[model samples]
Target: METDVLVVGAGPTGLALGIDLARRGVAALVVERAEALFPGSRGKGLQPRTMEVFDDLGVLDAIRTAGGLYPVGMLWQDGRRTGEYRMFDAVEPSEDAPYTEPWMVPQWRTQQILRARLEELGGKVAFGREVVGLDQDEGGVRARFASGEVVTARYAVAADGGRSTVRRLLGIGMTGEAVDPYPTLVADVRISGLDRDNWHIFPPGGAGDDYLAICPLPGTEDFQLVARFPEATAPDLSLEGVRKVVAARSHLAPESVTELRWASDFRPRAALADRFRSGRVFLAGDAAHVHSPAGGQGLNTSVQDAYNLGWKLGAVLRDGADAALLGSYDEERRPVAADMLGLSTRVHRGETRRGEATRQLGLGYRDSPLTRETRTHPGPLRAGDRAPDARVAGIRLFDAFRGPHWTLLALGDVEAPEPDGRTRLVRGPAPGTYGPGLYLVRPDGYVGWAGDTPAGLPDYLARFGRR
Candidate 1:
């Protein structure tokens, strides 16, 4: 089989990338080694920025319907309620940032929604196609599957998890440190005595005692159980083992855990791949970076990785853009991944709180080579910053920025370039969110270039093959 791009792994990253490419009319295929989608609710927190990405990918409504807000933590001592513990700092939604808090959706459900959207846009996912061999040349990439099938594509992305076979085959190295020495067990199960309104917390009673947390999963009857064990001790993943841990840690009896839906074990470790690109192949998601699940940054950062690369790939394949545009993927995302890894480790060690930084709305590409800021003195909103949402001249900025097209906001008579096949020009009065200027928003919704006048704008557009 031949395709424009071959995406490995059907996790959130690959599925979201498929949706982005499909909307751009790029022919791409997502291949997964597993027979079906992931079944666990391990990465359940959808940070506010990811919600915006889902909105542009046309899955926000379904996501909102499938999940609910996180509840306050209810502390239990000796089987009696002690006091309420707030998990996150409360923040209200504003026009600039619509999603203020993280939404609770199971990772499995999130992947399902993304897959359905990909299919709706005429994309396909080939299951059980484990890649055993990969060879790339100046033109395209040829991959060999375990079933002896050969597929070639112009580019390939390794979105497979941390133990990525593709990254290993490419001989890429990862630099990281163990966030914690203790092993953790995470599972989805049905419990008998816990209320679904609050996240139940069981603190360690004394020395040598471990803590356990059982949070209710939204849109389902299962509660996610998390427990920590002693250093160098392995976590038991069996049903009986889960029951024993629950009985020992919390006041609940072993018989309270009625059913086990899924279970897994892992040590909290953070690692980042040495690099993100190798010849025609690029690493994304867990393949590029792995985090301690403390700040709920693993899945959110992975999805954003796909979002950053999708448009660059689309530009090179579907549009007449320079192949050099793909280089920015590494230049832009590697630093962000490194920063997030540190943040996750800090949050895991209790050195930081999941506050405004965890929201991820502050992330940007201000220093990216693709960002051009030509002005005497830039305002609060400059090139490479996220263009805030606003209503200008009866048109919503996000509504105008949606879809697989570049947007030019000609605010308050600022000189702007004319609309082209791939660029849409929106002229309106300058909203307070963005001062009066010509702001060129990338397809992925970052201010790529900003200027007071149209001078040098044509040259910047030429870099994206937009002339």
Candidate 2:
């Protein structure tokens, strides 16, 4: 058939994009190769910045209801409690940066929430449709699936996980080194006699080859089990095999793990794509970058990728913006993905702690070509910085920035342009937010352009087809 945008893969990335497109009144379609949503507890942590994103997407309430805060880590030795290990550096919330810690929700549960949101916004996923071949020109891209259905769209996005079929079809190459040599087994299993209040870790001793961790998944009856094997060894994924490993490493008996829901083996590696865009096709999520699952950056970064691209796509497709606006997606996201990959590797290798860097609240496109900083000297919040949360004149900055529209904050006598329906004008006193400047906030909650006056504001608005 035909659509404005074709989103391949129904994982968190594609579903989030579909929701964004749907709310923008764009005709988008999402296709998935699997018969149902992903069933696993992988990618279980949502970073703080991602929590803000979820808040904007209208899923934060459901997500918070379905998940809980990560519990403290309980170290175990010889079947006895030894000491407590804090998994992340403690940080209090601030008026500028909220969501100080990551939230715990199984990846499957997170996907379910996103899918429900997509459906609520008038979008649906086409399952059991595997994309076998793809061809794109200057106008649009055509996708042929295994079911003999050919679909055409103005643009296409690849969010089909690390082993992305679309990336392989486009001949995109991923380059990076293996982060760890030990094989890892991750599974969701039902267990007994373990308190659900803390994450239990059995460190490797002289007798054991490696370590095993059992983390109780919030809002579920299962605990996620992660075990490491010796170098060059392939860990078994069978139920009996996991039972043996758990009994050997932890204090719990084999029968304690009563049911095994899902399990998989993987080698932790970090890799980034050679390019995020190829002609009319774009890469997102694991299709573009692969992380070590440390610092919980992979899934969060993937969702942000969709968040970054969604508004641009809406602008070009529906708002009469220039096609060149799309180029900023790669210019802005690639470097952030590279930095996150490095951060995940460092966290995995014990070279760093889960401190401020892992929070990802500071990531921005300051160097992107789209960011225009026109001022004698900018203050703390400049062009390309994340628009911090604040309340000015009874108007919450985020509330004004919500939905698919840009916000121009005329703070403290800064001359601002008259906002129309598409552009929201929020005038307020300086809560010391931007130090008396006109801040142009993008739909994605980034400071796109900032100036002391409305001198170059018209030109900036014209770039996005805004009047």
Candidate 3:
């Protein structure tokens, strides 16, 4: 087989990249080792930024229909009832920024939606094609599969899971340490006497040397129970072992839980790849970084990584930009993954002192060259930052930003008018009605350049708009 881009692994990251490339009229192929889609609920929460990307992919509605909207407020450790730290309270959405509510959907359902979208775009994932080996040249990459099939592509992306064969073949080192030896079992089960609306966190006091978390599954009364057991006494994560842990943590009788949908034992670790790219091959998702699923950032971070790199790859393939443009993938996304690794490490250590500021507010890239031209306060989230989503005018604008066109959000009638051709100007009430800013949005929905006035338009177009 031959293609423009060969994406390994059919997880959220690879699927997202494939969809974006196909939408850009790029021919891409995705290969997965598994024979079919994996079932069960994993990574049960989508952050606000991730929801925005989903909206741009034009599948947030399907995700919402399959999953459900879950607005999770912060939980206090001492049993004090504090006010909700809603994501909407931090970043207000506008006509350009849509996708208000964060979603709570299983990873499988999310992949199903992405698969449907990719199929519609004339790209399909080839399952049961395990990449056994690969060889790369100055021009392209050739991959060998276990089933005696070989494929070549101009570039190959390794979105494979933590134990990525591509990463190993390329000899990329993963640098980080593992969390202290503690056994944790995550199970999807149906419990008769539990509230499904709230996430019940039982710290390590009342329960028998275990910490418990109960999260609701959409469209069903069942809950996903995550329990951390003492390393000394925790049994292997068998069906009976999962039932015993759930019963012990929830303080309910063993018979109260009827069916165990899925159960797995995962040890949390924090590691980042030494490098993200080599020659014509690149890495994203778990192949790039792996951390504890503390804040549920694994899938979301991987998906966003794909979003950040997909457009750049398409531009490089079609427009023949500097190969250096692809280098920005690591430079931009590595820090974000590093920060997530630090945050996940802290969460694993039971450090929850940092409030919403640390969790929601401390994520932005204001220093990148792409964002430096924007005039805004220097903080995690600024003018050039990935704008958060909120409810604006009752229509989700994030969905509107998904297409392959430059978005000019005319906030407050600035001195500069919209550029003619190849740009979509979304005009709304000027001044504070639209957050008192003008954004030159890239096709992928990231803030390419933003300013209070339109003075930065020329530089913005010169930097990202043209070849």
Candidate 4:
């Protein structure tokens, strides 16, 4: 195999997977059809859970610098401010959840940051290499590119977005519905006569008029504009067209629309592939599941998919784990994607608000076959739940958990395991979230197994080919 893993599409999912594999010393390749990284602001909102994921991936500091908090929504009518619209329920930061809110970074900037980090780790993305077809044998998978090149890898992943070429070639069917039939235009533009303090909202002027929104893209001189049109009406993509929409929908003049950086139209939809895996290949991100932009779940869920699969792929390729360990990826992630699809649809149709659930901190893998709850009685942070970050005796839990190793947090004399370089062992007093027990945090920051003693710990470690 030319590489251990072949990641298609250099969006957030593929870049994140590349970064994880590079850190684990796995030889991998990332290919993108586009000439450069995605130059759009489609998936701009990053949830608190994803912030934690980035923290572990070593990009949180740069991500924090590249974005700002989501501003409060401002309502307008007749060129006057009517009231304030809360885009998201505000939450305060705590010791367990330091990143309480979603950070607004343009998707383009996020991809650039991930690409830079990948290169820093000696991994690079080959742009303009489009995979046209793929075939896999017992040894490995071969991806045929449009440039008449065949790239082989032990395994391949499809992160090539919703209309994934890999998925289509593999004949995976996506079952979903159109969340909104109305055509919507999302664009990145530069406009004046608007304060950057709030996300400006222009409500429907007449009975059949459409609503428009202009949000100042943080850390840049761009404003993301979204306008909803009636059914069967196609949005105009020209600069004059965007200026007309701004003038008609808002109080700003046509010329106030200084620059139309990028614009695209789509009908909001929710979809999930029939299967997350096919032989030597697996699907991820938009290829596995497509979500509505409402509630900001699509991109966050996509990144989490990478976070879940990265470690498993690393275990099998670099750690000599059984290939059966890879089966859990489909089992664990498919259900989560199905649930998030519902959540995104609910948030899109106004059936639900962007509440705590949207933050994704409560998501877990309790039913996953890999999760083990050996303890008779469990605390609030149990097996299959997200391991809450805490500070025990001046040692930050997240700081200790920030690496490509399994962490065994043995609290209060739980017969700590023998030292091993593969898994880091640490002992401390149990915090409030975790009562008194042994907590095993997975590399992806989830509590994989919990017990009162180290009775079944060795077997569990051996199952994943860990020492």
lDDT of each: 0.93, 0.92, 0.74, 0.93
Q: In model 4, which runs have C-alpha deviations exceeding 4 angstroms?
A: none
Task: Give RMSD (Å) of candidate 1 vs. truth.
Answer: 0.9
Better of 2 and 3 by lDDT: 2
What are the per-residue Cα lDDT tens digits for candidate 2 across 1-467?
99999999999999999999999999999999999999999999999999988989999999999999999999999989999999987788887777889999999999999999999999999999999999998889999999899999999999999999999999999998999988999999999988999999999965546998999999999999999998877787888999999988888899988999999999999999999999888899999999998778999999999999999999999889999999989999999999999999999999999988888899998899999999889898889998999888998787787788899888897777688779989898987767888888999989999999899888888888774
Candidate 3 regions off by >4 Å?
69-102, 200-208, 232-234, 353-362, 372-383, 388-400, 410-421, 427-429, 433-438, 450-467
Clashing pairs in 3: 98-397, 98-398
lDDT of 4 by residue, 1-467 (tens): 38999999999999999999999999999999989998899999999999999999999999999999999999999999999988887889999999999999999999999999999999999999999999998899999999999899999999999999999999999999999999999999999999999999999997656999999998999999999999978999889999999998888899999999999999999999999999989999999999989869999999999999999999998888999999999999999999999999999999999989999999999999889999888777889999998987678999989989999888876787774678877788888888889888899999998999989888888878784
Clashes of each: 0, 0, 2, 0
Candidates 1 and 2: which is better by lDDT?
1
Question: Could you tell me the lDDT of residue 390 within candidate 4?
Answer: 90
TM-score of every model versus the real structure? 0.99, 0.99, 0.85, 0.99
Worst 10 residues of 1 by lDDT: 458-467
Between candidates 1 and 3, which one is better according to lDDT?
1
Across 333-446, the per-residue lDDT of candidate 1 in tens digits comes to 999999999999999999999998888999999999999999777889999998889988899888889998899999997777787888988999998888899999999999
